[model samples]
Target: MRAFAAAAIGLTAAVALVLTVTAIGPPQDGTSPEPLLTTVPGPKK
Candidate 1:
């Protein structure tokens, strides 16, 4: 009985998480506008 209750609680939590994510939907801002890192020129040999 204890195992069954635990399994039920886990299943409920998983379903709730999936529903919440679906409701939130995708992000609107999209990708970053600038490059991740800047490059610097190397000293001449």
Candidate 2:
């Protein structure tokens, strides 16, 4: 009985997470104007 209850709770939480992400939708384009990392300079010869 305890195992069954735990399984049910886990399933409910998973479904809730999926729904929340779906409602939020995908991210918009150009959200970050600048790149995350800058170019590294070449090593001196």
Could you say which candidate leads in TM-score? 1
Task: Write down the TM-score for model 2.
Answer: 0.62
Q: What is candidate 1's lDDT per residue for 17-40, written digit by digit as tens? A: 999999999898898888875778
Give the lDDT of residue 33 in candidate 1. 85
The TM-score of predicted model 1 comes to 0.63
User: If scored against the real structure, what TM-score would every candidate get?
Assistant: 0.63, 0.62
Tens-digit lDDT string for candidate 2 (1-45): 999999999999999999999999988663777767667868889
Candidate 1: C-alpha RMSD to true structure equals: 5.4
Badly placed stretches (over 4 Å) of model 1 are 32-45
Against the true structure, candidate 2 has what lDDT? 0.90
lDDT of each: 0.93, 0.90
Residue pairs that clash (backbone atoms under 3 angstroms), model 2? none
Error of 1 at 12 (Å): 0.2
Candidate 2 stretches greater than 4 Å from native: 30-45
